[model samples]
Target: MDVDFGGADDILFERSGHAGIVTLNRPAALNAVNHRMVRALTRALAAWEADAAVRLVVIRAEGRAFSAGGDILDIYEAGRAGDPPFDFFADEYRLNAAIARFPKPYVALINGIVMGGGVGVSFHGSHRVMTGNAVFAMPEVGIGFFPDVGGSHFLSRLPGGFGLYLALTGNRIRHGDACAFGLATHSVPADDLPALLRRLCETGDADASLAVDARAVAAETEDAVMDAIARHFAHDTLDGVLGSLAADGGEWANAMHATLMARSPTSLRVTFRQIRTGATLTMDDCMRMEFRILSRMLVGHDFYEGIRAAIIDKKSTPHWRPAALDAVAQADVDAYFAPPAGGDLSLQ
Candidate 1:
């Protein structure tokens, strides 16, 4: 049975059997999330939660990329026009928190790129089903942004300081690595996703249906690099991490140093503190913290500058303010964690 729910054309909301389905339909834009898409998803999830007919929820995308990220171009345009678009972040963060606390089995069928906001909706769910082609990352630092969308919570919890390394470096990981790190719950082939979705919808039994096509991901011996990450990134300050890397003077260390140098110095410091603080907070608290960071980021100099260099100008040469990491004052970094004029996110 199909339920007719009105939403933006880029996103489809329907019900089939015991499952409520959300299909991201904007393939050309790579399913980039917008304010309308976020609102519709939040509404659909709320309605499904209250409806006895829908026992489970499945979120999947129609494009090659699950979702590259939020509609950053929109944000950039608004910021340039003197309107910071805090509404979008509020709604998106609320949606992330809702997914985290969703009562039913929330399954995300990921077969392509999943990063930034895409990770928010899917990773917080009870079931994160990924295919061989699926890639995961939180590349916000490159754009002078901290990894929001509940990244503070999830990233802080990943074992062995892998989360901080990913945050600072903006690295992408394949399905195998994601599964090994517990970021992905199940591994299914891309070709079998449709069948698996059908089984989930028909039966509303995630464990049983997933077991049919899913396999435990074997830990790669190469993942022993987590030990190195823990050693380099476990420091209390960004300078400490940089100092450790500089002292090593090795190939990998030098590469990481160069990568950090290319990113916004402010973003690197903010993300470092965000991850550490989130380790002590709850999911909802983490969202609130991210909201604070977002308020500051939208009004700051680097985010728009980063957008100009990377997206608008395509130059990939962002001249970040206070270009050096040492110039990012600890007080300025603390300001990002402070409450905004609108107050913190009220997740009730």
Candidate 2:
């Protein structure tokens, strides 16, 4: 196995015959992604795509979590320094878009926690494999920001109202629910993954055989909990959703209500709008919209405060401005979705 780019010890890259495997190497942080890791990953993928000997690329992570998410601590530091936060988002988003549209066969072995920016890298792959341990979500709303990193595109594509439900609630989808929501292609036992990867590599016909086996494995572990998800997540507003759940009076409903109450109200409204708007948008359009919202959040909103309280202060309490959901006016939410002074996100 050959390894390149020694600077990013947090990201491990190696080649096994015709297969290229990229592992997120930060186990202590649950493989959370930082700027250096993102840059290294982008470079590695580009190199593998160009290499004649590399027939496939596998993106997996070390530790119990695939990735906790993007390095929010870095974002907090940039915000505190009064730096234009758009720079980080722009670079990260560009990397995600590249992966979504990458030409070669991309396989994301989603073995554990895959959330927020984690989903951005792993979900768009041609072959997305999940294990019994995988837990997925877009918890950006909890941090007083709308979901980004192409979240608008993929979450919007979810069936029924599941997209909007997740955007606002920061709901955690387990391995079964992930398959039911179309967030993952295959669901195999965690133990089966290593052998599956080896088999796919040795199959010679990398593209066709991998796809066939991956789909079969996923179908075999199909989630029967889709009805419950659909029933709980179909409501339009947060209050309505809660009311419906409360009326049911089940333990699951109580747990879900607690989850929703813990997140930022303003973020929920903005995220709801983001997913709805994104549902009708192209990949470029989704990125552009998210970029606009995130740019504004950097300068004008309580994103810094949210990060400070939850991560820096370790308080778990975020005092959001216009704290109540009803206090957040339509105009205020509209401003986040509106175009920035410059324009939409551009590839160049």
Candidate 3:
């Protein structure tokens, strides 16, 4: 294994033939991506791009989970210390942009719990391989944050308004369901991952691995589910979706209502706008928009409280600032969309 770029080994990079491999090495922490990891990743990506021998890249984690998420505990402490989380978001979003615009073929092994920041790394890659253990989700709303890291761009493009539902409710999806929802491209079982990686490394191309026997994670949809999603989430307003859920008597509707009611009202309002307005924008635009929202959210009351209740205290109950959903007004939500303090995020 070749170690380069300041010799930080938390995010390991190596060259084997024509492929560059990245191993996330924080098993004890569920391979959570911190700013240091982000910096290491940034350096590796740039180095590989410049290296002539590197034809492809593969990113996999060394724990039960591919990644838990960004270091929320760090952010929680930052909040307590009266420090702003500006630098973390700035770098993390830049890394997401790098992944999105990477020239070479990028392959991600989605093995275990893949959520939040994990999605930014894997979801934007050229190839996303999900195994039996893969559990995909974007639960930022539960933490009083909207799905950033180009979420607005990708989620908005998901078929049948389902992105809106996932963004609001933070539902979990398995490997099969992930493929069906455009989150994964292949569903190779866990036992076969080693051989698949070997072939990918050997040929230095994803096509070689794709040619091998594996289940293609096709984007197939059920009519009933799509219809229900449309009925509830198609509406432009969160209140409309809530009204639809309340009117419907099915278990699915009831469950979704409970989840939505439990989420931060301001977050729901902002996220609803994020995904909806973001659907029409490019990936770069979506990231820029997220930067604005995140800047506002950092100083707000809900993010810290949500982190305290969910991570620190384990209470799982966050009394959102706007206690009632309807209390969040259009003006309140619009304030987050205003230009960020440091100016918009630039991929350059």
Candidate 4:
């Protein structure tokens, strides 16, 4: 058992009244999840699930941002040192699944940059509260990876094809937009989060802890801009999306077209298929597929090149193998869905 929870506090856990609280604590790293953190969190959550005294779990972070994602530098270094980076995703995905199926109230006070692995943990909670400082995105495509962490399952279900648009563009989700997209169930002011946490810990009730008066968030994703988005991103195929955007002469369309062009061609194609297929599958199913895809990505060229450009070298320019979307063959994308080298995730 990796239950030496006291020895690992990168993800801090505590009992407050009838509530179980977990705080992501690596402020300097923006609480980016590492392998130990994942293990610590999974153990804590499982323990909380077995403890009848706990009626709710509160997930928050102590820093400027909730979490940037999983530790990318760790993956890059592991590859450099010729070590396999497998346990992090395997455990992280298990934690994600645990969050999704948690029986008690799971509250997330997301009050900062929340992206990638951050979304994996927070979005699956029963109540996702976006604060004034909250910002969200799934930027996997830019790094030659598709949106994992149960994104394919939930993002595919958002209103008006907004989910697909986000998956493709890697755009930021901010403020009221979080509520509008149903990504957040409540919006609270950042300054009031401390008091809210107090109330939640005291009462172990999400509703009793949250109110709309000073914390209301209102956003409009319905605009002329969305019309163009709906027209282009609604296509089931990445090529179809590109074709529509390429034909449209609108300035916004042109910019978005260019945005798609900049992403990893393989990532985009695989993600396009990922979200569409994920819509028909369960969360666990989506995770299994993601595990398969990520296992393949680890051994591929673009993942390493992406890590080099985006994190290691700080160049922000990745030379994708299949540089253009048209260059990606169906067989190439299909291979990502094959059985993982480590076998399927052992969630049990």
Candidate 5:
């Protein structure tokens, strides 16, 4: 059944037999999440979790992209109005945590362009299924923000140094790479998804029907290219990572270098520290850290400018504050991760 929150159709929730489905409905902006969607989703999930009739929760989107990300336009407006950026982040993180620890089985159908907040909602699922066209990344660094929404938790868990690499470079991973990188559980052809989902809905034992041999799935789809990801992404700093890639002297290495070079240097540095610090953090600590950084960003970091240049203005050339990775100071990066003046995030 569909639920309405005011006039905004930000989220659509429906139930079919034992299956409860949540759809991100903002197709025009690639289903990019805004505040209303987050709140509606949280409410819907709470309802479904309490409903014994609902055995499974499937999250999908109505657009070509699963979700482009959190609504930067809202963030931009907040920054413009001089409101605390943490306000949005705190609420969003709460929703993210709810999804992560939700009692019922939650599945995410990652069809296309899953990134940033999309990852927050979809990646924590009990079963994350991707289509061949699905593209995934935590490219917050490109926009002068750290990967929030429990990215710290998952990014740190990525095998070897993959977490550090993706955090710094904002590289996009295809469905095959996503499965190999542990970001997704299954990779079925995009065309087969409708039937698979239909079968899932039709099953009497939804949980058992959705379950697949995790080991077999991993072995079959593990990305062979991850060795390169581990080796090249092992460096502590972006400079070192780039140098390693450059030294490798291959088409992939060259392409990766160009991609990294295009992102904001300040963002890259902050992202590096975010991943490193997040490596040892519990999920709670990571969320708290992200809140602190995001709060600071709302006041007047480069996030507004980055979004203006990249998304709104569509210039694609962001004039970062430091303009180069080496220009960002260690102390500045440390400050971003520091706790807010009062205390850590309040779970309640």
Candidate 6:
């Protein structure tokens, strides 16, 4: 059986065999999730959850990228026009929570670029399948945003301080690294993906269809790197982390120090707090925390400035307000975690 709920065509939903299938369509947009796509996906997942015929759900995307993230251009325009799109974030956050709480097996087939919003959708699911070509990153700090979309939950939980390292640096990682870090449950070759999909659809058994393909040499090397990451990022404060990196006097340390220096100062500090606080909270609480941050970020100066430089103008040189980490006040960072006037995100 197959089902199609038509709308903007940015996403497609269908039922195949025992698996409910979701294909991120809008390849030209790199499957960047917009408000419409979020609502559609939420509705589809809800419907499938109640349908006994649908034993599991499989999410994949068109084109070379799984998803680059959310539709920041839409967000940018809306915010610039003075109407912050709060509903979008609310609905999206609810969807993220719903996915996290979903009873059925949720399999995400990630073969290409997966970043901020992309991470929100796939990483929350039960099965995160990465192909050889997969590339993953958080990258939100670079855009003057913290890693939202339950990043506070999952990123905080990644072992050996790797999640904190990823949040601050926003570095793109490949299959080997993702596997080494436990971000990916299964690593499949591109050529084998089709067969894997077929088997999944036929059997609806995620564990049975999946096979671990992490390279021993790569995992061995990554273990060493994780040790370095754990050491440098072990500090409670951003300043302490930077000091650790500086004292090392190594090439990698120098590059990491420079990368952190380039990110928006406000974003860096807020993310540090977000990751730290998230470690102690539940997934739902983490989503609420991200909502609080989003409320502040959408109204702040740096997010727009970041969009202008990185996306609109392509200059890649955002002049962030407060410019340096020391200039970002503790009080201001504290405000981001506070509840919004409208209210906190109420998840169903």
Task: Give each model's whole-structure lDDT.
Answer: 0.90, 0.78, 0.86, 0.85, 0.78, 0.89
Tens-digit lDDT string for candidate 6 (221-249): 45666778999999989999999999999
TM-score of each: 0.97, 0.88, 0.96, 0.95, 0.89, 0.96
lDDT of 4 by residue, 152-232 (tens): 988988877788999988888786888987898888888888888888878877877786323666774548877788889
Poorest stretch of ten by lDDT in candidate 4: 1-10
Candidate 5 lDDT trough over 10 residues, lowest sum: 212-221
Residue 163 error for model 1, in Å?
Answer: 0.4
Residues 1-348, model 1: lDDT tens digits? 555455569789888888999998888988888888888899899899999989999999997999888889999999999999999999999999999999999999998999998888789999999898898999999988889999999888888778899899999888887888788999999999989989998999999999899976765537546677889998888889999988988888899888998999999999999999999999999999999999999999999998899999996799899898879998999999999988898876
Candidate number with greatest TM-score: 1
Q: Write the number of the candidate with greater TM-score, choosing between 2 and 4.
A: 4
Candidate 1 vs candidate 3: which has greater TM-score? 1
Local error of candidate 2 at 15, Å?
2.6
For candidate 2, report its TM-score.
0.88
- Tens digits of lDDT, candidate 2, 1-348: 858755358898888867888888889998888878877887887788899888888888888999989888888888788885676678778888888888777888888899887888888777788888888888888878878888899988888677777787776877666776688877777887887778656653445555555533333322433455577777766567767777877777677777776677778778777887888998878888889888788885578878888888897688888778778888988898888888888854
For residues 181-281, could you state the per-residue lDDT of candidate 3 as single tens digits?
A: 77788888888888887887888879778668468654334677668987899986888999999999899889889889999999999999999998899
Q: What number of backbone clashes does candidate 3 have, counting pairs of residues 3 or more apart or in separate chains?
A: 0
State the lDDT of candidate 5 residue by residue for 1-348, as single tens digits. 555643167788878867887888889999988887887787788788898888888888987999999989988877788675565677789888888888877888888899998898898877888887788888887777778889888998888787877787787878766777778887767776676677667773534554532222333323545677788888877778889989999887788888888777767777777787788998777888888777666665578878888889896777778777778788877777788776777755
lDDT of 5: 0.78
Per-prediction RMSD in angstroms? 1.3, 3.0, 1.7, 2.3, 2.9, 1.7
Model 1 residue 319 CA deviation in Å: 0.9
> Candidate 5, which segments miss by more than 4 Å at Cα?
4-7, 204-207, 211-225, 249-251
